[model samples]
Structure formats: C-alpha cells, structure tokens
Target chain A: MTVARAVTCPSCGGSIEIRAAGYTVTLACRHCGSVLDVAHEDVRLITAYKRASANFAIELGSRGTLLDIEWEAIGALERRSPGAIWQEYLLFNPYAGYRWLVLADGEWQFGTLLLDRPEGSLSSVKWRGQTYTLDDSSEIETTIVLGEFYWRVARGDSVQCKTFARGSSYLSSEASGTEVTWTQLVPIDRRDVEGPFVVRQRYKPRPDLRAIREGYSTAPGMDENDLPMMFLVALGALFIIGILQNLLSGPSQCVSNRFDVVVGAADTTHKIGTIDVKRPWQFVTIKADTDKFDNRWVDLDYSLVDRRTQQSIDAYGIVEYYAGTDSDGPWTEGSHHGETLFARVPRGSYDVYVDAGSHGWPSDPRPDTLDPKNPWSAPSTVSVWLAACTGGYSWGMFWTFAVLLFGVPCLILWWRHQD
Target chain B: MSKRLILFSLWSLFLIAISGIATWYAWSPFADDERPTSSAFRGPTHK
Candidate 1:
C-alpha cells in the first residue's frame, strides 16, 4: 500500500506533492527550489538550490512502463562532477521498489539497487557470471533536486562514487562514510521508454567517455572472432574446388612440333607447324630452348593466328644462361629454356610464327686478347616448341577475392576497437 | 527473433553473397586471361 500527501513549502508556500508519503525523508520545493528535511513532524530547511537550466527531457510525475512494470517518475536530481553533469529520475512502483533512470547526453541507463553487496576488490568485481573492471572513481555532488526523496539529501551533498562495467552493463557503488550502496545499470534505448506516457523533449547526444566506453563494449552484429573463422572455412572450400578442377582437367598435346631459327642476326620470322584445336577454353603453351654459350641470352616473339577469324595473339619467350666466378664462389642466374602460356583460345585452325634474336659476350672480355673485328660476339640457335592443353585453373584470382571478403570487416572492427 | 540474432543473420548473408560472387568470377567460363605481349629479354632471366 502507498499514500500521497501535499506539503506546503515554508519559504514560498508552493504545493509539493509527496507520492511516497511515509518513506520520503526529504522534499524539495518546486517553486522556491529549497531543500527541505521532512524526516520528523517539523520540516527543516537544509539548503537553497539554484537551478542552472530547466530543459529536462522527462518531466516529474510522468508515468511510464519499464521492464514490464508500471512506474511513475516521483523524484529528480541533477548531479555534477568537474565538467560533466547528469540527471537521475527516481521511479516508484507500489509492488516494486525504487529504480533510477539516468539521462546523460540523451543516453538513458536503467539501474536497480542491489540488496546484497557484491564481494570483490575495487579493481574488479563479479556479478551473475560476468566480470566487470573498474572504470573510474570520482566525488559527485548533488546540484539540484525536485519532488521528493527517501533520504535526507541536501544541496552540496557529495558522495564517493566508483563504477565498474562489462559490455553494456555497469555496476556503480556510492559510499557515504562507511555505508556503501551498489546499483547495477544497463543501457536502455531512449525510444523504448518514450511515447505518449513520456514528456516530449528534444535530445541531442554529445560525446562523452561513458557513452564511448559503453559503445565500444557492446558492438553490434557478429562476434569479432567469428568472421575470420568463417573466412578460413570458405577459403578452404575454395582451395578444394581449385584442386579438384586441376585434377579433373585433361591436358592433351595438340601440336608437338620443333623448329630452329638463326640468332645474332637480323630479326627473322619462321613458320612453325599448326594444330587444329577442337575445344574452347584450352591453353596454348609456347616453349623456347636455345643453344647458347655462357653469358648469352635469346629472345623470341611468337604469334598464334586463327585461320577462321584471322585473330592473331602475340606472346614472347626468353632463354638465357649466365655464369660467373666471384670471390665467394661460382654462380649462375638465368636458365637455358623458358615457356609462355595463353589461355581460353577458341576452337580453330591456327598458324604459329616465331621471330628469334640472340646476344652474347665472352665471360671475361679483354680487348687485347680477343679479335677486334668480332668483339667477342657469338651467335646462337633457338628451338621453338608449341603445345595445347585443357583444364587449367587460376588460383591467384580466387585468393584475391577471398582476401577482400575477409579483410574489410576485420579492418573496420580493428579500427573501432582502437577507438 | 532477438536483435543480436537478426544482426548476425544479416552479416552472414552479406558474407555469403560476397563469397558467391567471388567464386563465380574465379571459376566462370566467360573469364578471359590477359593477352600475352612481346617483351625484350633481360639478362639473367629464369623461367
């Protein structure tokens, strides 16, 4: 059961309603803004409060439903700490005890008092299987009060407050002398509590440490670790598909002909044998082998011309051999043979053309020991080989797409976590 | 469904769509290899 009473402010004679009649020990005058101690029969004035602003989002005495329980806003208090200020509205329900709805920069947090004190150090605390770390500690003073309160609160009354948080949930402890009270709070969306029941007022959210911390802890969407794990699974599946495609492919030699061309002379084009390709999406490989001395290189230009479409695809191949004896040891860099491949060639009769050239110098060229006319030059012979095959796959493209799919979200999450 | 479950489903859908597009691009028959070009042979080149 509950009772209601109307008290007259001794200073201004303004009507102040006390909803929790017997439980209220302090009442503030709505008109005069005077803190009155009404614990006994005679009400005593504790201190006078001057309000800085009257732009409150939720007015006093507004009724709303929270957590499925109907509650009325009975008392309001504004507290300040250094550069920050916040408002706390005391909600009262006959069947349920009092709860605090705090508003800071348009963000609302619902807090309920804990009957028993949680056992832990100030650095860390455990509550209902969740661990909370100490966020901050400060001394907060009450700046303004409205309606009624159950405690003898006065203007300039201060308490040592410490807060701990895990994810979106917070545990706050207010200590006055040796007595401490703990309240567990969680973030509540303002829209959930605003409607016809709530007083309409414009809310603009500002950047604050509390809001930043809470937002970082409660990230929306999938878990941070789950994305990478799923990406690995998808990548494995893609790899398996690539391997299967490679294994099932049939690589047949369409043209296995060899031809020789003179090098170290003017660039000359030679006609290689042609092959009638029967399947599309096949690869044509041009292999070049050169007979060269040490420190010599051969370059060959190749073209595959389709007889039906007259489409000519040009490709190049290189074969080189280099050897040197340094102070460390003997070393060689270039190979004597190389190959180039062209993929997705259409089915047609094709003619192959090769243009060959070569350049070479003695391993240790000395003007005094070598012939002046020849200048230690040598000519080489290049052999051109052509072959065609089917069933080839590109792994680089698959990996590239997979990396982008997994990297973007991970980068975003990492940036947010840093914030 | 809960808000977290809905968010998870949306994220999963986005990831799956991107993966499907990537797989198609990688394995599609319409994909063409880059055309080969003639290049001068440099010294000490390996196959």
Candidate 2:
C-alpha cells in the first residue's frame, strides 16, 4: 500500500486521512463529520454535520483482500431510498483502481464502476453480451458521508437510480443533473467480506437499521404490511352496506292460515291461500307452527305454485315437540315452529298448499290399527299454523362472500406480521 | 394512490358490485328452496 498524507480537520482540528490523495476531491472529517475540499492545495471545509462518525460496518482505512487483490476502504456513503437504505464502502488499490462494496439487507455486493455505458435503455440493458431486465428504480439520497471521494459528495445529494438485473448479476445507473454513471454489481458472499474486512458484528445492520438509529420518519406508502388497513376499510364499508341492505329489504306482504291434522289419521293436503308477490325479484319465507303435542311430530310440505307458469317452488318444515323424563330429568327436544326460505322468487300470485301429517314417537302404526280405547294412543288432533311472506334475505351468504372477498389481504397481513 | 391501493380498490368495488346485485335480488346460494321429487324429502334447515 502507498503511503497517504493526513490533514487536520478545519472544523474540529481532528486528524483526517487522505487515503486516495491525488484522485480524491472531497474528504469528510473523521471526528467532526465535516466535508472538506482536498482537490486543491488548501484543505477547505465544504459542509458541516453533527454526529456523522456513526459506527460503520467497515471502518475507513481498513485493508481487506478481495478477488485476490488488497484494497483499503477509503470512503463510505449512506444512501437512502423511500423504502430502503444501504451503505456503500469505497475500496481503493493503487494498481487495481477503485471498487465498491455495498451492504444492503445485511448482504454484500461487489460493485465495479463501468468505464463505458451499458448498451440499451433503463428497462433492459446489455452489458458484456448479457441482457439485464429492469428490477427497481427509485430516487436515492446520500444521507451520510465519511472519508474521501473522487466527486464533491455532500449530504442530501440525490440521484435517480435504476437497477437492471439478470439472475444474480445486477447493473445500476445513477443519473444526476449533468451526467449519468453506471455500475455493474454482483452478489458477493457476506462471509467473504466479513472475513477479509473484519466488519464489526454490531454494525452489520439490515438496511433500515441506520434510519431507525438516526430517527428517520417516512410517509405512509403502499407497503404490503399496510394491507390490513385496506382490508379493514373494505370490511367497514361492507358492514355499512350490509346494514343498509337489510334496512331496505322491506316490510313484507304475507298470507297466513291454520289447519287441524288428525293424529294417526290419513295424511291430507290442503290449500293454504294465494299470496301476491308484488316485486320483480324477492325471497319468500314459509313458516309452520303447531300447538304443543308431546311424543308426536308433524311434518309439513309446502308448494308455492306460480299462477302464470304453474311452476311449483317446494319446501319442507317439521314442527315437533318431544318431551320425556329420561336420565337427564325433564328434557324437551325440537321446536314447535320451523321455517324455510326461497330466494329470487318471481312476481306473481302463487297458490300455497301444504301436505301435513302427524307421526307418533318410536313407532308410527297404521291409521286403522290405532284404537280410541287405547289410553297411550297419540293425541287425536294437532293444530298447525302456516304463513308465507315475500321480501326476505340471507345474511349468512352475504358475510360468507365478504370473508372470501377479504381473505387474500388478511392472509398477506398475517404473513407480513409473522416473526 | 399506489398501484396496490388501486388494485385493492378495484377488488373491493368488484365485491361491492356483486354484493349489491345479490342483495337487491335477494339471491343466495344458501337458499333452502327444494324441488319436489318422488323421493322422500328432508325437512327445514336452520339459517
């Protein structure tokens, strides 16, 4: 390694090493983090910032061997984009010229400044006979600077950077106001850098760590982790919509009637009445209720016959009440009322009929075999009330659709929050 | 707005549109309407 000249900082009077003396244009003070112009005879201060000498992964002036060449770390820059931050360490060898060792996401990339521009546009570039596709593009700002650089680098210097990638190889172009510079980068093993440069364990931070340490705040953007809010908003909107839908559904028009069925007698089908459906499309609800009768169940089959088309929309309901004193004391099973719904029923006058029958518990004997003399015989008659109405909706289907609709976003949020 | 938010908005709009149609027509895949056949039929299903 060639001997380098050391200069005293004009701001803090701290010793600053000019490792790349002749080629270096600006140098940052090691102690005071002041940018100094070193291209001329006088060491002049350019800019001053406090607490700039934060712990870097690879300290300036550290010598490391890479690619069978020994190079000294001469400068480091903290570059930040909207979503990420990375560190670039300028490595210099007199015979080998200059190279870049970039640390991002706790990973290392060996970068070489391209002397000639890569062929093609920002989207797809051909370099060394290989094509690279665009990977990412963002505006990057230099937030911190240390040691010496060939250009007059300063804090808050920003550039539009675009990266093109083909497999593990990447080509990046950083365009400033006057000129654009390209660099070819290849992923390098972290162990190769750590073993040679002896990077401090504590300073090897994932890209965002520096921003956190420096108290950086960013505007809320379209980060995938923010998907939960999107889903919540959608769900909230849907909830309000559901409430409105239920409220708008209606005060339904209904027709109701009652019938008496003789237990242990022959089943009979009776016409309930005609219900006028006034809507173009609506749901029809059929309900059946029975006066209490123990040890016997009544089944009602309802047929809503559309008058014009003579098409019957059929449904079934069971009104049962079974009570007994078993091991669990006095317990009752089954309800005395049951209902069923039909969706999207067309508008028309419909004749509703119900086929009702009653059966005894455990065994249902022939109607002729039941005797009036038998004391344990089922009740003689059971009264059933039937009603049919229009304008009803199913809330279950609506919520099921909502769950399916918001499922993907919920899954992404869950995945992003894991660990 | 970001591309992700735009896409999410589109998705939400699509769901809302279908849900609006479903609600207006009272259409539901879970409707308990039955078809009358010669075979024995099962009774009412709780919502």
Candidate 3:
C-alpha cells in the first residue's frame, strides 16, 4: 500500500497532499494555488499564485482503473502550441510508475515513457524495428499547472517537441535545455478511456459542412473558397444545357441507304439520298452500321454536295469488328457501328454520296462466302448502312465543355487528397 | 454566397451564356473545321 504525505504550503499555509510522496518533486497548494517544492524536507514555495483552481475533465487525486491497474491522476498540465491546446494528465500507479494521458482535439492518447531512446534524427526514427516519419514539430508552452508532478513543472514552462508517426502510433521527443525525453503514444479509444478516467465531457466528431456539400470529409486544406461548389454548379448547369440542346436541336432530315460490297474491294462512290438543311448552321451526323462479319472491315467517306453551289462538305466513318480465338482465349477488337459528327454545316439542298470499301485483316482474307443478297452470313460480304442527318447536336462540344467545367474542381480535390 | 463564390458564379454564368450564344449559332471551338482529307475512320491498325 502506498502512503501519502501531508505538508503545509510555505506561501499559503494550506495543507497539500503529495500523492507520490518521495517520488513527487513538486506539489501545488489546493487552497491558494501556490506551487511548492516538496523534494527537500521543508516544503519551499516556488511560485505564489493567487487564483481559483481550474476545473479539469478528470479531477486530480481521483483514482481510476486503467489497463487493469489502479492509477491516480496526480498532476495535470494544460499546454498550448501555435494551433492547438491540449491537456496532459500525469497518472501514477505505485507498481506501474508513471504514464501520460494526453487529450487533444477530443482524442485520447496513452503515452508511455521510453526506456531505450529511438535511433536516428528528427526527420525519421527507428524504434523496435519500426520506422516512424516526422509528422509535426512545434514549441509548446505550459499555460496552467495543477496538483503534483515528478519534475519541477511550473506555469509558463515551455519545450520544443517533435512528433514522428507510424500509422496511428506516435513517437514524441520533447527538448528542454540540455534534457530531452521520449514518449511513445498510441491512440486509445474514447470509450475505453472515458469510463476508466471518469471523464465528464464526451468527444463528438465534428462534421465539416463544406465537406458534406462537396462529398469529401477528409480532404485536407479545405477552405471556404467555394471553387469546388461553383464548379459543381457549373457542371450541373452544363448538363441541363446539354439535355436542352439535344431536345431542342430541331427536327432532323435524314437520308439512309444500304450497300453490299465484297471483301478486299476498291472504294466505290454511291449516291444514297438527299437531305435538306434549313438552319443557318447545323451539325451533320454521319452514321454507319454493318452486318457482323469476322476479320473484315467496311470504311465509308461521306460528302454532302450543295446542289446550289456544287461544293461539298465531307466526313468519314467506319464499321469494323474482329473476333478470334488466340492463345489468351477469345479476343475481340473494334465495333460494328460507328458514327462521325460534322459540326456547323451551312444550310443547303445536298445530295449525300458515300465512297465505300471493304477490306480484310492481314491484308488478305478468305473468299466471300456470304452472298450479296443474303447479307446476314458471317465471314464474308458486308452490308453497310450509311445515314446522314441534319440538325444534329454536337456532343463533342458538349463533352468538351463538360470536361472543362468539371475537371478543374476534380483536379483540386485530387491534389488536396494527395497532400 | 461568399464574394468569391458570387464572382465564380458570375464567371460561370458568363461562360454558359457564351455557350448558349455559340450553340444558337451552331458554332463550336471544338468543331472539326478542317476539310475532310483522308478517311477519318481510324481502324485498329491505321498509322
């Protein structure tokens, strides 16, 4: 059983109990809040502070069972870095000696003092075959001190601390004057520590409002610039515009015809049909679909000849499909249906003509087994259906606008996650 | 809205307006303006 020694504060004459007795170096007067040096026989006054005792989440001198060991919160230090403030509770068990429970940003870390120092510099360190990389470095100042400590800790005590992290585990080194101390801290779930320590206030995860809107909660360096949100709105607007443009592009006039050609045949120009372009400028869509044929391809070059001017606007398309069994099993390449878009063709009466040809793979292929009239037999003659439509919407422009509208915000979000 | 968001919204609105006007005239910066030369049909083995 551990015995506590009661002493009188030299400054305030208030009774203060040293929980650790011989091991405790300093004790703060509970009555007048004065720091007293208890290492010597006579409890000497270090600093006379006449202030009200600060409230703690876990009251000092309270005994709690943690890690199956009964430990008492003997000392508490409130420290502040540049961006954050945290509370450190010094716990003591006569057999287990000393431990630190750090509460920062509503997260608890159970810290154990290192008996053997970690090897290497501040940037990286090796401990027990595990490598830890530098996470952060900051100068911490003790803002408030209470109860008893094993060291001569006073208010305004400062130390430069460097923390290296391996996953969720952290190795921290604090330097003050010529002395440096290392501590290994591992995250302890709030549920595990709160009940054991009799913590009053519970920790709740705060949600970022912007993150909920932007669909990412863990993105670092997120600010209220609203670039991402604006991009989303722009993308949404563009999508609506694309849908409207597609719906309201006006009634289309289309001309279509089918031509049967033999494999490895030269290009032959055929007059399909005529379509009238009544708009000032409109997109022209050229589409081709062919009956499925193995190891063969059909290529078509289209021309829209303006009957008034005798000038032509041209486009090209192909319908090719190949499938065969290889060493890696069945493989297929290319598509049987292809569409090519021509944008902003001027209004005119035009005769649609297509220069068509059919070729085989390996530059030479088997004779045409499919009859020109049959058209559905495989591995032979290919029947190509060519169609031209006026007043078609430019999906190319829509997609280009879509990428530009949405890509910037996505890139920024990606960069933030990378950081 | 924040000032930056308002400014960005205005800029996006301007872009949408431009796109609307351009689409009304069937004019697109990404349009294939080059006259059809060779076959645009790129086969699997076309160089």
Best by DockQ: 3
Q: Model 2 over residues A148-171: C-alpha lDDT tens digits?
A: 878777666789999999999899
DockQ of 2: 0.24
Q: On residues A155-229, what C-alpha lDDT tens digit does candidate 1 reach at each position?
A: 567899999989888999999999899999999887777752465555544559997777876765434435545
Per-residue lDDT value at A157 in model 3: 76
Clash pairs, candidate 2, are none
When sorted by TM-score, best at the front, the candidate numbers are 3, 2, 1
Off by over 4 Å in 2: A1-228, A247-251, A293-295, A321-333, A365-378, A417-419, B35-47
- CAPRI level of candidate 1: incorrect
Residue A278, candidate 1: how far off, in angstroms? 3.9
lDDT value, residue A334 of candidate 1? 75
Cα lDDT tens digits for candidate 3, A238-337? 8777765765465598988988877765688899899887877777787888887877778777788999999988776667877777677887888889
Task: Please tell me what DockQ candidate 3 reaches.
Answer: 0.30
Report how far residue A286 has shifted in candidate 3, in Å.
Answer: 1.3
What is the alpha-carbon lDDT of model 3 when measured against the actual structure? 0.77
Q: How many backbone overlaps does candidate 1 show?
A: 0
